[model samples]
Target: MSVSVMAATAASTTVGTPWINITIFGAFVAITLVVVLRASRNNKTAADYYAAGRSFTGPQNGTAIAGDYLSAASFLGICGAIAINGYDGFLYSIGFLVAWLVALLLVAELMRNTGKFTMADVLSFRLKQGPVRVAAATTTLAVCFFYLLAQMAGAGGLVSLLLGINDKVGQSLVVAVVGAIMVLYVLVGGMKGTTWVQIIKAVLLIAGAFVMTIWVLAIHGFNFSTLLGAAAEAGGAAVLNPGLQYGLTDLSRLDFISLALALVLGTAGLPHVLMRFYTVPTAREARRSVVWAIWLIGLFYLFTLVLGYGAGALIGADRIKAAPGGVNSAAPLLAFELGGPVLLGIISAVAFATILAVVAGLTITAAASFSHDVYASVIKKGKAAPGSEVKVARITVVVIGIFAILGGIGVQGQNVAFLVALAFAVAASANLPTILYSLFWRRFSTRGALWSMYGGLGSAIILIAFSPVVSGTETSMIQGVDFHWFPLSNPGIISIPLGFLLGWLGTITSRTLENPAVAAEMEVRSLTGHGAEGATDH
Candidate 1:
């Protein structure tokens, strides 16, 4: 049958195995919950709770990192994007993969060496503890919330598609269930449990993608060129060219650059990914983790390229878009086309795992930021009662989960990858410049840190709120509203530079430089891992 005919039929009907999908998904969740229970046996101290007691090996931690990094955006969004936009859609994969070099060379080992638990730990090392920690924690929570929204949205779309629930109420219930599960994971497992879940999810996700990739290639005689030709014929010859998505208007081209910039710089600032480094014991292990993660993530992105085009060739974009879950339905639908209801069930399970794991990771990171940084360091004056912090963290987890559920429900139809890009823009704007300055510049002051974080965060948030993403267009979150003034959907192009500029300006204009002796100690510790282990517990 022609691809169009096949897709047209399947578009109106789901794979006809909601029970199978639910059963498979339920099994995975039960298994992971057991793992979390077992892992929580070691949650004795703040370090144990937040950084896994630094017990994980390099490769293990690396695998977990890949799981945390390759979010729903990478799987569902990018696949659907490629199925629709072709070459331009693959740019997200490129930007995401290339982002690791920044993490590896600039942040990974250095971060692991310098700080004990959170990103705020590193930022507050030499600077004024109170102000810097507040700024850092605020930004951390904001980034986590944004990232959480993407994962929750993906969960809603993925599950709703599987069960054939097309109503807003059904999708919202799906998102809430996901949020509750994520809360359970973080509240029970803490970092150690979350890390283990991430590792298992990483293995399953990568393995599933590999199987699908090979199956697709085998059917095409293992020739990529053949796959591409078929895809072009199935969709259009224009699928072979650039600008299918981004070249429509000058504004779109600029938006592409903004998206690329956000993706490239965002990882260095992602709190959950940064926290992954703390799971390992030594700086060397941290570097090794990055190396392992790079290989794994790079390989999986390659699989996505094939998977994307394969979907385009096997099922036309129009049908994929018309289906439940909108664009995010492409991968699951492709699985159904290739291997019927069984593969669809399995793929749906893996997709659910992807969203669940990432959200759990983000939730714990946010919880840690608040309990450790704000409540412990700032509010308690660095003397939180032992065990009290974790209690606070558990509470924060529930609150964050509730907020994520509401936010996810608000953003149902948007592409998961595009929403993730906005999160990246905020991370890049609010955190990266401050982090780079704190590591590299001796004159970088507490004033600079505050300026950079707040300016970047404020600019990014204000611009996003005023941009077309929130209103003014058909695809926007708010319909029948036309208040958008910012032309680009993403604000990275302006906010990122403003962050850097503000940091520089705030530093040079300060009447006082940070104590030179403190700066020297930080420089020595950050670069050489000297005194980093004996560093203050906070």
Candidate 2:
């Protein structure tokens, strides 16, 4: 039988038999709950609640970072993109991998050496605390909320597809349940619980991807060239090169560049990813963890190529499109075709765990931003007790979780990768410039940081709201609406530069004198780690 006919037949047969998948998913959830419960026992102090007591080793922290960073976008969305768009889809993988270089070299050590609980801590170190904290907290919340929504949406779609719950209400219920669980992970387990969940999920995800890659390679006689040839024949010769999905014209090329810039810089600015640095004991460990993460992430992206091409070669693009959730279903369907119901169940369970882990991380970071940065520093004037701060963080977790559930339900039919890309754009545009200037530049005042954060954030939101992503296109989130005036969907190319320029302009225009003592102190501590926070034991 031909690939398309075979995939169609398989789909027809697999519609109602989701018992194995449900059981596997149940098992994963149970294990996660147990891990969280145990981790909660150690999360008594604010330090423990926020940074896992700074106990994770470099390798362990690296694995957890991988889990936190590799959302459904990396596992399901990227695979789907490659399965559908061929070589064009793999571009995202490259961009994501290259992003680690920026994190490793530019941000990781400085973040570890300087920050306490949130990215706001780092940015507000040498600058005035109140305004900078508020700005950082706002940007942090924005990035976390958008990223959380994408993960939650992916969870709902995966649940509906894998468990055969097709109704919109059913999917929304699933999203709510996932959101509730994520809240519990942060509220009870805190950073320690979330980190453990991420570590376990990372292991399972990497193992699942490795198995699938090995299976696909074996089927193709261990010859990558043969596999690519098959994918080319299945998806057409265009599948072997770029421009099938992007980079077709001057405007499209600009859009692609915007996307690449966002992905490359966003990792360094993500609040959740930055929070991971504090989970390690020393700046050296932070550096080592990034190295480990780079290796693991790079390997996983390589395996995604196998999974994507295998899906195209074996299942064909048409069936993948016709599948529920479109390209998002590519990895799961490929799992089913290659390894039967058992493997499908395993992969589906892992994907679900992926969503849960990412959501948990995002929630904690959002909570930390709210409680530590906003509530404690801004509202309470930094007089809030550690225990009270932890309580506030728990409350914030519930609030953020509720919002994420609602947002996820609202964005159910959208593309996971596209949503994630928008989150990246926001992070790159709003957070990256502020972080860079605060860390490196002596004249980076509170005004400059605020302008960078608010300018980049406002520009991104306004552009996206008026861009083709909102309307004026068939793939837009809002159809039958043509109010869009901006041409490009991704706003990083314009917004990122605007952020940096606004920072510069604000600094030169402001009369705020550069504090030489504060600058020297921050420089000395950031480079030598002389006054960094110490790790606490349970």
- The deviation in Å at residue 74 for candidate 1 is 0.8
RMSD to truth, every model: 1.8, 2.7
Which candidate comes out best when scored by lDDT?
A: 1
Task: Report the Cα lDDT for candidate 2.
Answer: 0.87
> Candidate 1 residues 32-92, lDDT tens each?
9999999999898999999999999999999999999989999999999899989988999
Q: For model 2, how does the per-residue alpha-carbon lDDT over 1-538 read when each residue is reduced to its tens digit? A: 6785776845633433588888888898998989999988977887899999999999999999999988999998899899889888999899999999999989999989988888988888878888888898999999998898789878887777777665678888988988887777777788898999999999999999999999999999999999999999988999999899788989989999999999999999999999999999999999999999999999999999999999999988877766656668888888888878788888998998899889889999999998988888888987887599989988888899888998888877666887898999999999999989987898888788889999999999899889998889877777897999989989999999999999999998989776878888888878899888742100
Off by over 4 Å in 2: 1-16, 534-538
| Among all candidates shown, the one with the greatest TM-score | 1
TM-score per prediction, in order, is 0.98, 0.96
